[model samples]
Target: MNYKTTKILWKTFVWIVLIIGTIITLVPLFWMLSTALKSNAEVMQFDMVWWPEDPKWSNFVEAFTTLPFGEWTMNTIFITVFTIIGTLLSCTVVAYGFARFNVRGNKTLFIILLSTMMLPSTVTMIPQFVIFRELDWINTFYPLIVPSFFGNATFIFLLRQFFMTIPTELEDAAKMDGLGTMGILGRIILPMTLPALTTVAIFQFNGAWNDFMGPLIYLSDPDDFTLALGINFFKGENNQVQWNYLMSASVISMLPSLLIFFFGQKYFIQGINLSSGIKG
Candidate 1:
């Protein structure tokens, strides 16, 4: 084929695939919304309603009133915000150190850090719980939010890779101007790595938002419960599950991450590409 004709054909194929993929991904979300609007009887009907026959918008209201949703939401937000801030500050600093400086035993320390990532969190769960209990941190937000301040190994590694790609000449120029390390990081390195920071913030927010197990184990009171933990309250001792309410709550819970991805999508893609060691 001629060059123009070949390019047109490739573009056509890409569009077709994207449209198909979009439909596939959106199907479940559409179903969730449909289900949320459905009444219990309509949901159980043998003949499925593609959309609600009489959409019960009150279900969302009922979902909130049935539990201490406001408190739960506040708790979740607190955790999410702190986790994002902590991960960004701590991970960026650690990654900068690893990428820019050569300290004695740095390699060995990095290897140990990476090794912790390989170890299953389940193995450390009990010991971690005991330590938290001793510190009187149970039933509080500490156990959930504090760990992020130390940084995540995987995110550190990702940020480090991106930092290493930055040209050293930029730092050299900054140094010649009498800029200290913190000044260079604050004025130059950080601005240049906005993509990576946004990416890490998004990931940390999602992780904190979706976390159920950690909250389940650490939080003993409903007042301290996060949104993920609050979802379990929709179940009964008799195993009668409130599927509609659960689905509605889940849909609502997913909005923040979706919004973050929607708005910061460009940075996210750039971060992924840069962190993968590709010179775009």
Candidate 2:
């Protein structure tokens, strides 16, 4: 019960907790991969099959071929690309304005905008559906892609905070060099904001890629379905759930998100830190 012994015991406890948490978090992912490699018989076994005896590597190939995974992936990519573009274009400008401009009612307007976030989407989902229905946007990408062109509250807030961290002296110097707002944004702000922009792009990409609700609501054509909806479709297409194929499809679907995060992790962490007011 000396100080050194107590500190060592505390560190041991913390490490044990962290190890347990890590295992808990990774178990589902491990299960999914294991199931993907299993046969239907192996998957349906009474005892838990942690790993398959005969790993069917062909499940990945069959997952794509059995379903229109390629086409669904293309549809998803198309939606995700446009969603990222729209979110970046709209959120950057709005955030920049909120961070830089001293227009009248600016604070009030921003507060109102932020307030919208507190209003659950379920409250407005019916109204939005009605409007989209009137516009004949059902079964089209418009309902899914076009909304991002406006702005996202959470992304706007993140970008706005990051933008505020930038020195106004830069803008002043740009103005002295005859750079107007757009010129300064393009020449000065953009290069410096790459981390934050990448963060936003990654967020939007993951969201649009995994979006099931939007595509389910707006899309009717099986061919136009996003990967998320396609996965659901694959689940329901068979009377008995083919857990192997479903798990294989899910594993394939998650690769892009995992890859993006793996590559962009440094920028993502930096952006989050900067936006949260931690300088450097």
Report lDDT (Cα) of residue 118, candidate 1. 92
Error of 2 at 271 (Å): 0.3
Model 1 pairs whose backbones collide: none
Candidate 1: Cα lDDT at 19: 100
Worst 10 residues of 1 by lDDT: 241-250
Error of model 2, residue 132, in angstroms? 1.0
- Which TM-score value belongs to model 1? 0.92
Give the C-alpha miss distance for residue 163 in model 2, angstroms: 0.8
Local accuracy of candidate 2 as per-residue lDDT tens digits, 1-280: 8999999999999999999999999999999999999998999999998999989999999989988989999999999999999999999999999999999999999999899999997898899999999998898999999999999999999999999999999999999999999999989998999999999999999999999889988899999998999987655544778889999999999999999999999999999999999866
Residue 94 alpha-carbon offset, candidate 2, angstroms? 0.3
